[model samples]
Target: MPSKLSEEISPFYVMEVLERAKEIEASGGSVIHFEVGMPDFSTPAVICEAAVRAIREGDTRYTHSLGILELREAISEDYENTYGVKVSPGNVIVTMGSSPALFLSMLALLDPGDEIIITDPHYACYPQLIKIAGGVPRTVRVYEEEGYQIDAGRLRKAITKRTKAVLINSPGNPTGTLLGPDVIRDVASLGVPVISDEIYHGLVYGGEAKTILEFTENAIAVNGFSKLYSMPGWRLGYLIVPEEFVRPLQKLQQNLFISPNPFVQRAGVAAIKHGKREALGMVGEFDRRRRAMLEGLRELGFVLGTEPLGAFYVFVNASGISPDSHALAFDILENAHVAVTPGIDFGQGGEGYLRFSYAASVSDIEEGMSRLGKYLDERKNKSR
Candidate 1:
């Protein structure tokens, strides 16, 4: 039998929706995909070219376990430029992606039974990551009426003696809500170390997303090239830690991942220094789709308490249609052929909601909304 730890890890439910969508495609049906968080944009050419150049130059050998210095330095410069946070290159550690960066941080920070607090309706994998790191996750429920923003007061109330950290994601997945600097300040005041997931940083559509580092040095900021740079398959991500934690985290990285791909690290340097133009263009297109999605969902009678201002998703309340989001999601897949993530995949707070990703093309978003509207109309007529 697998160890109890392995058994304890829950499956990421959105993958189930995606797999079914794939099966439908394989069976000669078209599916409009909004269930995944990945950007559909092609990687910027300069970043891609950098990797090819590195490969041709024979730069594929194992690199420093902390990643190549150029990439780390580039990341440090980005913090200064993007967030006004002066980070040292020594404090950045690159890994295969933000997932491993967050996981490694948890592994280093968590002792057995230590508690980490996360917002309810969070990314589905957070609790599992906590569990895998030998920690327990304490969930603080943030309501949709509040735009699902984490309440620092409630978060403070949830912290206990065992609480070691508070995990936060801005331009959050499944919601695309941006947490402002005020909220980051409030959370920082709670006296718990913060794990800030800023992977969706550059994808904001409206208000600016703040880094926890802007308020506290006693935090970990996890970011990567996947979302903004459209380099998901490149598998490069990094974390900014307090100066004191650098060596230990470096040792952990050495043992666990050795390093992220050396060639990919070369591409990462190019991505930081030169990929902004392509990334901004993609963000503009995402904003276009986001607006269309919000208008369409509202028109279709899905309740959206507030307009999402970041990332590429709009979390819709689907309780009026069906309380069972999982079943409803699959039903939409089978009948409407439009794939979306069930809110229950997020957490109990998300039970009756569905997260619609606007990462698809604008035309695809329009077609998806039309299909959903037709499906709902037919269902309504049948009920009548």
Candidate 2:
């Protein structure tokens, strides 16, 4: 039998949808995928060339468990230039990816039975990672009616003596909503530690999302080269933690992962320095696709409560058509050939919605919408 931890964790329905899509493709049918948060773009050549240069220079051996000083320094300068936060290189801890950075930080800060306050319709992995670290997730549901924004008052009410941390994701997964600067500041001022996941930092379309470091030095700024650089396969990320937590997080990382790949870190340095032009370009293209998906879904009768300000997803309310989002997603995949993520995959608050990723090309988005329109029209006609 699997461990209790693994057994209790819920499965990712997105992956299940992907598997079905793959089966359809394998049977010679085409599938336009929107089920997972994956980018369709390849890593820019500039970043790839850096890896080649590193291989030629034989920079393949292990470095400090924290990371190579040069890369950490690059990350430090980046935060200073981008967020106006003068983070010391000593505060940055590089790991295999932001996933481990979050996991290790959870271990560093949370005791067994301790609690973490997470916003609802959150990244599916957040609560599971907290539970795996022996922490209970205290979720505060942010409704679609509120643009999925965090309400300072509700967040304050959720805190307790057991609340060890508040995990905040800006330009968040699923909803693509940004927490207002005031909301972020108010939460930081509550005196609890904050894990600010800025993985989608550079992908904003309609508004700016601030790094928590702008408000307080006590938050952990977790970000990576994945979303912005389109380098998900690189598996490299960094954590900016408070001075006190650095040693403990380093030890946790030392035991789990000695360091991120040497070649990957070498490429990460190039991505930080030279990849911005291309990264910003992707954001514009994503904006175009976002408009296409936004207008198309709304025209098809999927009610989006808010304009997505950042990230690549549209968290749409599908309750007007059906309350069972899980079944609705598969229904569209089987009939329309467009796969979307079921809202329930996010949490209880997501039960009657669907998350559509606009990471595909504009043409693909148009074609998927065309197929979706037909499917929904048929459903409407049959109901009559």
Q: What's the true lDDT of residue 139 in model 2? A: 95
The reply for model 1, stretches above 4 Å from the true place, is none
- Tens-place lDDT per residue, model 2, 1-384, is 888888878898999999999999999999998876967789989999999999999989988999989899999999999888899999999988899888988999899999999999899999999999999999999988888888888989999999999999999998999888988998899999999999999899866889999999888999998898999878989899999998998888778887778989999999999999998899889999999988988788776668889989999888888899999999999999999999999989999899999988888888999999999899999999
Q: RMSD for all candidates, in order, please.
A: 0.9, 1.0
| lDDT, candidate 1, at 342 | 93
What lDDT does candidate 2 reach at residue 308? 85
Question: What lDDT does model 1 reach?
Answer: 0.91
Task: Specify the highest-lDDT model's number.
Answer: 1
Q: After superposition, how far is residue 281 of candidate 1 from its true place, in Å?
A: 0.5
lDDT of each: 0.91, 0.90
RMSD (Cα, Å) of model 1: 0.9
